[model samples]
Target: MRTPADFCADKDALLVPAVRIVVRIVGVEQQKQGDAHVLGATEPELKCGPGVDNDGYFDADTPLGPYYLAPDAAIRLLTYDEKAQRMGLTDPVPVATLRDVLKACKSGKQPGTPYTCSGGFFHAAMDTKGVITELTEIFQS
Candidate 1:
């Protein structure tokens, strides 16, 4: 278990910040830990600092990026196209695409094929704990 001092030290390390990435979750599942959620995606994760750049898979060993979201993590569900427009993204992944994929995953159905779509991303600490401190989901007006 992490002691108070250990937690505090982790918090302090965030001041310098490590890395934040935008991950499009194609699937989600409750982890055995019960306190965390596992997210899977087909596309490479993108770094969300300074500029969006390729960050590779959350699991470098595998082609699919499977990441864990902390129990207290914040989650935001919003319209991807709208968020993309606001971000001045010329090409935006439609929310419907991600929705369908997630739906299939939840229903124990494999997606017909892999495709790229936009939903939201979480800022993770360098610790690899995959804790999301805050998240804001912006929807269409």
Candidate 2:
């Protein structure tokens, strides 16, 4: 239920203009370990403001921090990474390290997206490193 005005949180300190990026982070137990899931599960989320300081996650210019997009929101995938480099999209361009990717995928089982009165659904199990590496070839080809 976060209105557009609500998403106006500050990015860390990248000193870039405010660029909007809808971010999704997977947690271990469906529930965030600490302040992780501040934006609830199912509903679309407003920008939560700056992310944890370069915690091996998305590499955005701290200023235009990443925000949560409510789970129910139908977001189209943006392929502007190559186009939006200076604007602050390419930061996440680097492939997640094998360790970080593994840990993040493990967090997926927790199903961070919020649900209605019923609660939530678990989108556990995403592609593993082996799978991703194999899939990466498609992009290479």
Predicted model with the maximum lDDT: 1
- Whole-model lDDT per candidate: 0.39, 0.23
The alpha-carbon lDDT assigned to residue 122 of candidate 1 equals: 29
Q: Kindly report which residue stretches of model 1 are placed more than 4 angstroms away from their true locations once superposed.
A: 1-18, 42-64, 79-101, 104-128, 134-141
lDDT of 1 at 31: 74
Cα TM-score per model: 0.39, 0.18
Q: Candidate 1, residues 11-92: lDDT per residue as tens digits?
A: 4443233344434455667777655666674333222323322312122223346665555554433332343443322223
**Model 2 over residues 17-104: C-alpha lDDT tens digits?**
2232222333112224432212222212332345533221222222221223222222211121334331111112222221233243
Error of 1 at 67 (Å): 0.5
After superposition, candidate 2 runs with Cα above 4 Å error: 1-19, 22-24, 28-67, 75-104, 107-141
